[model samples]
Target: MKRRTFRAEVAHVNRPLGEALAAELGVPLEEAARLVDVGAVYVAGRRSRDARTRLSAGQVVTVVLEEGGQSPLAAAPGPAPTLRILHEDEDVIAVDKPAGMTAQPTEGRVGDSLADRVGEHLKRTAGLVHRLDRETSGVTVFGKTPEATTALAEEFREGRARKRYLAAVGPVALPPQGTIDLPLSKDPSRPGRWRATRAANGIPAFTEYRVLHAGKDFCLVELLPQTGRTHQLRAHLTALGAPILGDKRYAGAAQAGGIPAPRCLLHAQALELGHPRTGAPVRFEAPVPEDLARFFAAAGIQAPSGPIRPLEPPA
Candidate 1:
């Protein structure tokens, strides 16, 4: 189904969010509230399910509408897709998350998220250790027991886990290897978006990249994020002037290296962390998806074979 998105900046304050959306979109207040009820509304780059939320001047609001003025998020529910299990043990369960599936359920949305699917598969509770963007596919782990969950969560909170991602971006003019150290925060002027900020109040984010292949119009690179922040890789790549292919939110090209790309070309290729139960180092790798493999072949670059080596210490 075709969908259209509308964004508006509030000029007046102290009004119900639904009322502001109705004025901006020329829809009834009830329709605007229904949009929020279905998770179709976003404020300041985050989804807001509360129609009664108070709006402030200069705040941005965004809504997605399907053809014929229906909320795109109000579609009929479907059965959860089977998961691709990478590894499972008494304490932890690792799965290869597919693109287009959210890591967790969103408020006011009716569908099974990755977490729901995992819990259903195991017939018990599963605690997510970390999260990935809905469009990013890769290895993600969950803890089965409370002890395991706390231990694993602590590892990530303490910055002891290592992550590596593969991405294809528009041709980069920078060096083959470099680092992006930028501060990021919500874009006050644009709803549902983040931007780099030079102000001290912005959150610090750091990402290191190494070019693996450079075509005439695109480049394949490996990304290592030292600090985990929302959309860190996507924002950092955009800051470097080489946004990932098909990343419409970041001004990426629809086609890269003479190939069509329908979604952001980014993959969480591998993850390494100490086991919560045994305290032993363990690594999980996800095979490159077919879409990425096709990109690699079109670019005349061979995909990495065998286990991916650990990322070198940042210079």
Candidate 2:
């Protein structure tokens, strides 16, 4: 990663740190403010807070942006026919993602990704319109061109796109289901991690869960989130006292006698949106992955029924 730093003075005693930094760096205030926003700025060798805080003269501030580039794994050729195409067209394509494959490449995770495999299969570069968790596998859609990518992104930005997930939670007793309304925010102590809290400072998020079947130690669930945020579903389920099995990072450890989960028991069951070019509604679905299916079978849980429910906005 590339790193850059700018040194600036605190001209006035009451000037906000971000405003002063932006003025000194000759960049937009918002762009300069992101240093503090992402916790990258330090004043006098200590972490600075609140872009609006007053500043003192001669106070040195450091702004840094770690360089980001394609992961090395992205360079390795994808395994032949690794991607399973579920739906394809001139403008858009959807694939059934396998567990452990990232939707896109990240630092140190280059070779094994949906983009690499999909690009190899279609003989065209695939652009990710959105993302799914690395451990949560299932259907993911992509745009074949820059224009298509932009249109698909706009659909998600305008809240016209819908996504649903399927998960297995151990010892299911959650009300055949109910909505989990919680606000989530990044954990202050851990970067790139999120937590659910009743605190009002976080973004609004909601997930509706319905129990499909209950077994002796596990339950199949259909999950619908009204808004997407980092780790919203996992955190919400954890808060509900029925965290998805095999979710070690969030749920601690896999329970004994519970279907032995190897990954987070979450899948992108379906996606519904409009064609970027044609403006026609489109929907895609992916079946439960073998891991989850095998877990259910071993636990003696019945097959989950019903296509995922689509929640409509209040009329």
Candidate 3:
């Protein structure tokens, strides 16, 4: 396969370079991003790979297409799913990762995960700083460079990064709001499942929840896990007796109502951390997905139109 290059003029000013390029070439958005990451996208004869760069009107943009460089999102059998990069820079990019997508590759699954898509978009294997459950959707971080990757890992490891989620739970109502401070450990029988324990060897996990609104059958809440433990919130909520809606693994979403959960109603709504390169505090929020928002409305639970707030104010 030969390398293909296309040149176009930016007719619209202040538009994302990737969107412009994608439209110009009719490639998927992720592919446009991959082109930028590989220095295939340029402006003013200078190599520019940042997909989020706003192109000025009259800027001559060039896109060099690498043959066989199909993005995972594009290579999939059907229409590609739409995913957006919330923010990006030289060192890192924040993507609005979709629900039901794995964070990275697994056994027998190579190019079907968010890591694969974003990795191709960035034209390199991105360093995943953190992970969201396959059923959880929200702002996910990917390190574009090795230095950025290491710094992001350190931020989460040192407990400098903060993450918050929005969830819907129901049927057996909780006590308005409360914190679940318990220990968590893997369940031997369930293999991948986790359980709350008070055993000496169990790892401590703290999850806080505040009721946003109460519906006849369900309640919307904002959840914060102080410690990053696998299935922490799901286990904690089960212990609270109000399982999240659509969370069949723990709390049965159908147990709340007759309707089956389309997917786990969990969103990584908020993230706050220091910039990998500058150490400046930065915050990113993912909008409430349309499906989740509809669920809230159907249950008569009010979803916040604005940003979600933590139970306790930021410290």
Could you tell me every candidate's TM-score relative to the true structure?
0.75, 0.69, 0.70
Candidate 1 vs candidate 2: the TM-score winner is 1
**After superposition on all CA atoms, what RMSD does each candidate show versus the true structure?**
7.9, 11.5, 12.9
Go through the candidates in order and give each one's C-alpha lDDT: 0.79, 0.73, 0.75
Superior by lDDT: candidate 1 or candidate 2: 1
The sequence of per-residue lDDT tens digits that candidate 3 reaches over residues 163-247 is 8888877755666667789899888877777888786368899988877777777677788778998988888887777777788
Give the distance in Å from residue 232's predicted Cα in candidate 3 to where it truly belongs: 1.0
lDDT of 3 at 188: 81
**What's model 3's TM-score?**
0.70
Determine which window of 10 residues in candidate 1 has minimal summed lDDT.
Answer: 1-10
Please give, for residues 103-185, the per-residue lDDT of candidate 1 as tens digits. 98653233357887898888987999899987888889999999999999998899888888998888877777777889999
Model 2 — which ten-residue stretch has the worst lDDT? Answer: 67-76
Q: Which candidate number maximizes lDDT?
A: 1
Worst 10 residues of 3 by lDDT: 1-10
Off by over 4 Å in 1: 1-79, 305-315
- Return the candidate ranking by TM-score, descending: 1, 3, 2
Candidate 2 lDDT for residue 250: 74
Among the numbered candidates, top TM-score falls to: 1
